[model samples]
Target: MEEESGLSDVLPRDLASLFSDTYTEESHYQFCGQQLRITQLYGARLGVAAPVWDAALNLCSFFEEQKLNFKGKKIIELGAGTGIVGILLSLLGGDVTLTDLPHTLPQIEKNVSANILAGCPPNVCALSWGFDQVNFPQDYDFVIGADIVYLKETYDLLLCTLQHLCGPSTTMFLSSKMRAEHGTVDFFQHVLPKHFNVDLQWRNVEDNINIYKVTQFQN
Candidate 1:
């Protein structure tokens, strides 16, 4: 499949074909039975070109259920592929910056627009990830990432990006699915202590589905 740049009514349908069997034109997620809308695909399941596997919705459920108050907070989401979490956070009352590689911006923007239930929330921009590569707004109360640790080499870049934007109160909330023989857990364990108070919120230790809730960011 070629990289797509704009939202076409048929684009989601086309993406559905590529990730067939794993994709659904419509999927619903429940945030305390409030019934949030989501599309699920093995990759971009929502017919939306977003790269989120159901993990993004799971993250949203966690925050919503926990009653996270992002009110008047500066927030950022790294690897915001579909922009779902970032958009939802904005709706939950935070100022949000949604960033990903430039190419994925269109899908994210489309998803953000499409999934907004009542009216649109403000979203800042789509950017590439690099330390100080972009200007920081300062005083980040929280940062988030979902299923972003897909490569070992990207580890350092991810941490550097986190350090670049976060202020003292920042909490990095991450959700990931562990793939066999993948070093994501090792990567998290290695760096969590350097910047956060790490704890396993839930780990399907048998199936490799893991959720980590991190807080108290240092430096």
Candidate 2:
């Protein structure tokens, strides 16, 4: 798995400190036979959307390991923090869109701009879960998310957004760091299965991350 030092171990003790002025950080990874330099903007008060998380790295690894073909696929990544997963997919020839909360777009856009290919540039957009999902089309070939199922408050909203984004044949791959306190497992085990057929695709035992392959349940 891709590893980064510093900030991952030491986070600010003060809650207010997390909302301070934004600083920049960079992470490097190998994907699709190319070294990717991903620029991450931190301390901008963009919770969960600033840095590249472990789950995101693991998801990228999962995609490469599975040898999934992304060429010509229309993909959308939800809660696309740092836009790493979508960017990697875009590199693999997928027509990708990276989406997150409005405030999160700048960092995502920066990363997308920094790593633009000649003709495979990924689009960045603001997607506020349930509220703005209607603006996006529902026929994406693949819906991808990493570490997005933590908040209990937004469970329903996230589900609603997933429903709006997925068409009949759309497949979803969601990677999550299984933090018990955050109710991640409950959302995957109980809530998600109701609307989608969920299957465990991969698991990183050491990091407690799991990747699930999901598709809409047919009646």
Q: Which candidate number has the best lDDT?
A: 2
The digit string of per-residue lDDT tens for model 2 on 65-86 reads: 8899999999999989798999
Local accuracy by lDDT, each model: 0.63, 0.82
Residue runs of model 2 more than 4 Å from their true location after superposition:
1-21
Report how far off residue 127 is in candidate 2 (Å). Answer: 0.7
Q: Rate residue 144 of model 2 by lDDT.
A: 95
TM-score of 2: 0.90
Q: How accurate is candidate 2 locally (lDDT)?
A: 0.82
What would the per-residue lDDT of candidate 1 be over residues 58-156, giving only the tens digit for each residue?
A: 787677768878878778887776677887777766778777666666656666666665754657465445644347665778887777765555667
**RMSD in angstroms, all models?**
6.3, 4.6
Q: What range of 10 consecutive residues in model 2 has the weakest lDDT sum?
A: 1-10
Which residue pairs of candidate 2 clash?
none
Error of 2 at 50 (Å): 1.2
